[model samples]
Target: MSNGKTKTDIPFRLDRLPWSRWHVLVVVALGITWILDGLEVTIVGVISDVLQKPLRWHCRHLRQVSWVLLLNRGSRGSYRFLLPHRQVREEEALHDHLGTYIVGTVLSAFSFNFASIAVFRIITGLGIGGEYSAINSAIDELIPARVRGWVDLAINGSWWVGTMVGSALSLYLLNPAFFPIDLGWRLSFAVGASLGLAVLLIRRYLPESPRWLLVHGREEEAKEVVSEIENKVSHQTGKELEEPNKTLEINPIGSVGFGTVFHSVFGRYPKRAVLGLWLMAGQAFLYNAIFFTYALLLSKFYGVPVDQTGLYIFPFAIGNFVGPLLIGKLFDTFGRKPMIAFTYIFSGVLLAITGYLFMIGVLSAITQTLAWVVIFFFASAGASSAYLTVSEVFPLEIRAMAIALFYAVGTAIGGVAAPSIFGALIGSGSPVNVFYGYLVGAILMAAAGVVEIAFGVKAERKSLEEVAAPLSEVIENPY
Candidate 1:
């Protein structure tokens, strides 16, 4: 309730709690951001066929919806650490969920041309970009550090769950028996938007990070939130909870400016910065290179109908989601460096082999998709881990901004050009040409793996404080 400095063990208290329904609630409520993001993109990918036509089954839209991905980097870092993070997240979610729910990209479906839809697409992109900092920060602070790596990977991996839903929904909606082609694509957006609104409702009951509250000198509020969590956990688990083992004396300060954060991230923690950049950019390129144009490859090279492409996404989405679940535990168990480096290099090597097979004209569409399933089984885990790395390696003071910068920079460096380049490769109808793109992606990923070997932070099972002291603690410890 006061702005005076407060000393509290909020971080220890949060990190020491046993697994309970409270954690599950935290995951479901905040984690939906990734799911909705995946759903929207997959829906676009699934319905690209229908979106090309609007009035009277005639067509007009972007060459592809890949531009949305590029623009998602737009609104990041705009709202970093200004207000309370949870409050900022709720506000962003309100704007994003409401905007989509009201008109959906159904407006895009009704567009007169590409320019019209691009406007709406840009709005959606900015809104989604606005959500990541808040979501990742909240999830990192709330979840127990012992399981942080896996939980983060699982939440990020849930994006594929959205892909599954989109693929299935598109199959049903895009069917001739169910709806007209134009109408079907619009419905996909509407459905995703509705889901967004539903999750927003759930997010309402979620509490602010007690760690955050304590640092802001809202000690009473922090204590109440932590106590309520303990009560729920104890009641639900039928066990008494042990006291937190340590305390943090947080001298609440006004704010850490963007300049101080930038210097700290790039200057004080430059090696960690390199690790984050490579990890993020590598996965960004690999995912964007493959995902943005897989449908075109199916249609142009494999003779699959555009409408049936969702069937291919089925197995692809399955492998992507499953990889994180099965491999995610190893991130915490085996440690972040080895697991991260292994996934990146292994997937990269696998992708290289697969690309060579693809270039030789030996595999069918089904077989190619199967290859992706294998490659991404490892790649998905790696990609999801990339976000976790950035969120955890930085000081909590700059965690939100650091994540925002890495995502934006990484996507720009790797994600932006891969799509257009790959689209042109697919346009050439040359398997060897497309494989060149795959080769580049493979090299990028493998190189990132090498970077991990050299520079990755060993953050597994460490409290956020130990990983990188908060800026307040930095002023106290020059070491």
Candidate 2:
């Protein structure tokens, strides 16, 4: 890697390895990031009602204001830009975020006013927001290309697992009879943050991305990491692993800048940039707008008590988690473009139909939740695929940073405003208004599906280098 020059078989070595304990370890180690995020979000959602109810009379006061608090968190995703240029190794970045979130989550234990809650949530968001880039890129690089889609989707789907657990726990925490209203809700965020300490410690045992290593002028470390992983895989399987399928040779560069990534993502691969944007924006809006604020809807129009909101959310979480767990393989088998498109389109149509039912007063609380279950069954898988599409389709030089960019941009375009728009609509206390919000989300998702059909890359089963060659390999921008 001297002079940022190296020819290596790192990609082939990783892509060729069979699923083994090492792969499982990789999944467990890196995959838990989503689970943690799910847990945090669920806890926040459940406690959100509690956050507002410092006084019984003032309970619904922050109903509309809660949406702005959520918007504050989404805006903190701009913290991701701080690392895109540097991409400090995974565990280190996780260390910074894990600690930052833990501290912020702990601080929320004392929040009373809108300002306090808002500030603490921003700190917490900054922590999680910065880490999304590291874990997604690591997953794609470490997992075998053969099963990358399934693994990625399944991991992404685990987000609901956290939500499920949070929702279930909320049933107890939100019960005024079970615990003091103020104390119970405050505990949710704190306890959720506490659980992350163990995961943060576990992540320390994980290795860096060999693909990342090769590109960053650390060829020897990359080889050592790969060799160690291969040995473990052999021992776990009691069989020799396959040899490299093909090697990626390049004049490895140290890093990429905004100009390089801009050219590569937009100039070199314009369609992919558009596809990534659409996929990311649609999912961000759908999740942030409708899904994040569901508890409020149940409490608002459905006349469901706040304590009971989680019970309804329970089935919804299961539907979302199961969607990608089941539908993930299709991304690998049916191909990335079609499966991504189908799921997005199908979910959008389902949501529109369900929104119509809700607006017409034909749906009960139970039916409305069930409708969410059916819709996110497809939507969950599609949303998970959005992250997958962005992570793998870019060159290795900018892979991790590229993911961060998409997430931040998506959060800006889709994440930041979706809540305020929907919040205003929900605050209107009209099902018709909320339905219009749902309609907007559905339109965005359906349009993204259409874009996928036109521009999505054929990345299924392809090595990272093959899907999009390392920037170093490109003659035009050889670093």
Candidate 3:
């Protein structure tokens, strides 16, 4: 019953429309994945108030101070002054463990966050890994080629939207008044989990990328899914979809495997990978060092109100959001090296200025907050763009692995030292000289920027395959 041609021969089918409604749905669903990601990363910030409580333990009896001192004083000159130090006879290592916790027990504040954060960060970071890769691959596959750049920009940019929403919820609904003081952070987590579950549900409707499937030799499945998309688009638009020119298809780019990613990217583009990795690591160090400890820093250094800390962080997050979206486009339009270099250079200078202001005691609360905003703006923008450019410069086959490895190594190094290093520098019980820490961060940031400029590869207008093939040839036939 076909009018002009067989329905099977029709290039654009109802189910596989070029501008299908289904594709739009898929993109939105992918955005939710990232929202969950952002929420997971920042959820603990809202919960720190509750997590800081010290665990309680009951002692069996009040032993005499003389008995305690006589039993267990260590071998030292001070011990000779004391008759003897006594140890509490206790069950197993419980007394030893409890003794450590008891040191902070009498203090007004809590202590669990120091340990809880380590575990929660690992869980949240795992989800983040999946979220970044899944969303990028989904958008690349789903969006049409002509509008791909905009889609890429739009989807990746949506992460900031997710972050802002989490911040708003943390500020308003997740406050202690809405839930029991102990459960306030739980509420924020529940909200984020619910959103994550919703995204998981919606993702069920998304078909695998036809291009990816085709490269894997699932041609029939790819064709069927493509047809389905065309059909959906046609039905939504109430117009027949035009078929893509069949002759336009190119040969399949060579498939990259696990090792191929390292070989292709690091072996061929060693300078770019090294430069990107350093920048990435430095960015993580600075972001975590500042963001994790901002409240304490502001309270002590700037005399900012405790209640206003979230407000200050919100503006910094806004800067983080804006930097990536705008800078990424410039990376696409102009060049990666230039944008990366400019962002880091300015960010470093601003950080130094911020430190100097604090050091000199000339910065008022508002001015200090402004300084944080400016530094974070440039830092976050360059950081995000660096990841984007790194991915684009690798072949599609190895792109995922490259991103995962780079981020994993960079973030791991940063994660381990951020707390201890920043704490030592800022919380050493001396007069708060936060400026010294910022000065160090500025130096590292500027060094990363310079190294990137000297060695970073330009991927301004190249496709992944184009970037990878020549390198492969050089490797196979090096002179």
Against the unseen true structure, what C-alpha lDDT does each candidate score? Answer: 0.78, 0.81, 0.54
Candidate 1 wrongly placed segments (more than 4 Å):
1-5, 53-69, 72-110, 475-479
Candidate 2 lDDT over 64-167, as tens digits, reads: 45653565557455565665667476657767776777777788767766667678878878777766777788789899999999999998898898888888
Ranking by lDDT: 2, 1, 3
Best by TM-score: 2
Q: How close is every model to the real structure, measured as TM-score?
A: 0.92, 0.95, 0.72
TM-score, cand. 2 vs. native: 0.95
Give per-residue lDDT, candidate 3, residue 51: 43
If ranked by TM-score, best first, what sequence of candidates would result? 2, 1, 3
lDDT of 1: 0.78
Pairs with steric clashes in candidate 1: 52-59, 53-59
Worst 10 residues of 3 by lDDT: 71-80
lDDT of 3 by residue, 295-394 (tens): 5566556665443456666676677777666555666666667877888878989888877767767877677777777777778767666566555666
Candidate 2 wrongly placed segments (more than 4 Å):
54-64, 84-87, 475-479
